[model samples]
Target chain A: MHEMALAEELLKISDEAAASAGAEEVLRVGVGVGWLLQVERQSLAFYLEALRRDYPRLEHAVFELDEEAVRVRCRVCGEETEQAGWGFACGACGDRDVEVVAGDRLEVRDMEVRTDDV
Target chain B: MCETQGEGHQHRHLEVHRHAMEANDQVAARLRRGFAARGILVLNLISAPGSGKTALLERTLEQLRPLRVSVLVGDVETERDAERLRRCGVPVAQIVTAGTCHLEAGMVESHLAEVDQRELDVLIVENVGNLVCPSGFDLGEDLKVVLVSTTEGEDKPLKYPAIFHRAELALLTKADLAPHLDFDREELLRNIQAVHPGMKVLEVSAKTGLGLDLWLDWIRAKVGEKQSLHV
Candidate 1:
């Protein structure tokens, strides 16, 4: 439900970046989704495709998704490891006091654009 | 044809590096600044449905009767919670999210405009009962309070670690029922500590008024802290 809104934001940002760069069209946009955000990638992609139809400049654009991993540091053993799921227990010492390091970011990493000089 | 077309057009890779939630975060930051300037302490309460959030708040409001406090209730669709809070004699506003599972900063910012910020010491935003989506969205509150009940089992903090990790304080509601149920206190506390090592936990039974004083005192301390900063 909210993914559509998020997807719209991504497109708006991409469009603005493209326009500022004097690009004729966006070729591809890279998005990084954090594990904690729980955004549905497929739904976001679908919405991106449907909304792009309204913009001729984005008709040829592709939305790429990159899922980030949850990394944590154990408070007991001081071990840092990537969590496979929501379990925050340390893999080595089985300590529950593991601090989350990353994977809580949602950002547009980069974009490829084509200039009007064609 | 590919080589000819590639030679004719200029393709460039641009670094756009922007947060996807930038729009919401910006509004949330603005609201935080606005609250600080007004010396208002805002708290966003989040929990799973039936985790006793509204009930706890109702009791809390009654316990802190003399305090100037207001509430903003968020629900999928209902004025029931708002009406219930109104009985406590505080100005309450109901924000119907329509179908959204969580309350975003924009919603809070808009509803906040209707309330006179200068008149209140505390503004409580009861988020739409959800642990997942609400944890990811910042509502510009000074603190995020997560509630879990004894009946929900001790593993709840482990099951929904995201909410636990994001919360500054975890309130173990329905503490009166702990004796009747097989709720493992040590296990639950350990789980919460695991997710947030330094997160503060409070046990209170809104029904029995047990531990209610501590809760009220905490609120007062926080309010005083916020006021002193502006002074």
Candidate 2:
């Protein structure tokens, strides 16, 4: 799908989620994305501005992305460590068979809505 | 909450915790929904310059020609990639970022308006050839494929683990030149696996047509899955 279309979908989902939650206005939308997605923030912001023009309800809506870091869990010493850069060696055990428990996430964690109307 | 003022003037205190990229996130969410509705499986390809990303795309477009796939390529300047892809007869759009390091959701959205989304099976966004900054933004792709050419060395995965860890699939390109270079496939694979366990790794040679079938099959399956989801 095109980037604009994807942005529209995300906005729609957020709108639905916010409306269902009875939000008067969504002030903040927290999103979690893993390091692997390679998203261009400025481009996405430009698209969101376009979407906001159409959806007046989302005019004040803010999109916050919580970038999940690349984390590796050691198999030898059972130590979990975030990659200092891109190297995946465990900080404790220096194990190469370290498992990635999180980081590849793309979801709306929470939305801060004005509850004054409620 | 108590409000205080220096001059004893009553003023409403505003607690503002606004995100820097809130607007972009909203647009990305919109883009995601658009793909879901049309059943389009979008993949953003990121890699370093001279990493054979376009060469891989040329081979991919040729193989997927029968399927009628389309491409949206991003470059800092020049229609070179778009022109090269147009030779294959697929609907191609060149997103010239001018001076930008990466392609954003808004840029992709604007280019998308030029083409009919319903006609496309798979839409591949070849992002500007960069590893670091590209990994920080979302273009609303369903999957992110990070390509690392063999000549770039096996340590690339360890150096740029963010792209590797975020990638659903990693493509090790330029397999044909691996023999002439000091590139170790096992070490590269091991390094990638260390960051992304259970991640799909496919080695391909655009020059030799090696491992193209496996890559094509994987893409076909993804498109098929999207079709099923739409149904």
Candidate 3:
């Protein structure tokens, strides 16, 4: 699955960040998956854990993933709201002329790590 | 017992952006800049396995005369699609992912040598026959077009919104077989709008040469837009 690729990227990116920050051990990682893209959280979590052992600094790392909900701005009604999980339409008006203002982002948000000294 | 929260072992938290797509996105952006600077219009074509992407591409290559077009196609294995496209008398390259589901930007970047950007007006990438994974990754194309065959159900757009949402245009292929089948054209258009409102759709059949002129015009317009930017 593509989750494997995403997980590998997370480790590589996190490892680089950890190394640059002089982190001795990566304690936690944060990843944000967009709802529109449809990346499964459990599958991503599994791969992140499965691949952590490869990166020495991330051997003890735990991942925290957040799903960014899709938000749309309606053109006809000028209403903005979160999509109701499936087929998208204006929540206020029944118009389909809406623009996606948020969501569809697949990214690593922030991470926490342990350094060599306090 | 330890005196503190690990007495001498220090801890720190950093708000960093090591996104899952950071590396890929960076590569894609660079590729996009290169293509734009060279005055090239790159279109990434994505669809299901039997959606006739190669057939449509063959028709396009044949009809887009004097356009100086090149192609880069991807599949899990084999150079078959590349061979089929080569018959159209244009430069073509086949990228074998060796079991990967989709093509990444780095994979495409490595194949840049296959085509001479200086002599090319447009570059078409035939993505691996998949709807989901390919839509998730970006390859720095100016536009992403999804092809849907008439044999498939009309709800394809609603079923796979990721790619539909990513695409600015939709191609309903195999229009010649429409009368023989029970497919509702209006329903399909409605479904496409449900996911992507106001998306330009063209009903084309590569086999029967239906609506090829309209499709070609769309391509010409896109290429012209890019060339104008360079001037």
Top TM-score prediction, candidate number: 3
Q: What C-alpha lDDT, on a 0 to 100 scale, does residue B139 get in candidate 1?
A: 81
**Residue-level lDDT tens digits of model 2 in A25-109:** 6667776665544445566667777887666556798888667776878888888888655546788877677777756445566
**Cα RMSD to native, each candidate?**
3.8, 8.4, 3.0
Candidate 1 per-residue lDDT, tens place, B93-154, comes to 89999998889899998887666777999999999988777887888899999999999988
Per-model chain A TM: 0.80, 0.76, 0.83
lDDT of 3 by residue, B39-117 (tens): 9999999999989999999999999998999999999999999999999999999999999889999999999899988
What DockQ does each listed candidate score? 0.53, 0.09, 0.64
Per-residue CA lDDT of model 1 for A1-118, tens digit only, reads 6676687788888888888888888888888888877777898888888887766778898878999888889998999888886646788888777887778877888888888553
lDDT of 2: 0.76
After superposition of all CA atoms, the RMSD between model 2 and the true structure is 8.4
Summing lDDT over every window of 10 consecutive residues in candidate 3 chain B, give the lowest-scoring window: B1-10
Ranking by lDDT: 3, 1, 2
Q: Which candidate tops lDDT?
A: 3
- Better structure of 1 and 2 per DockQ: 1
- Judge the docking of candidate 1 as incorrect, acceptable, medium or high: medium
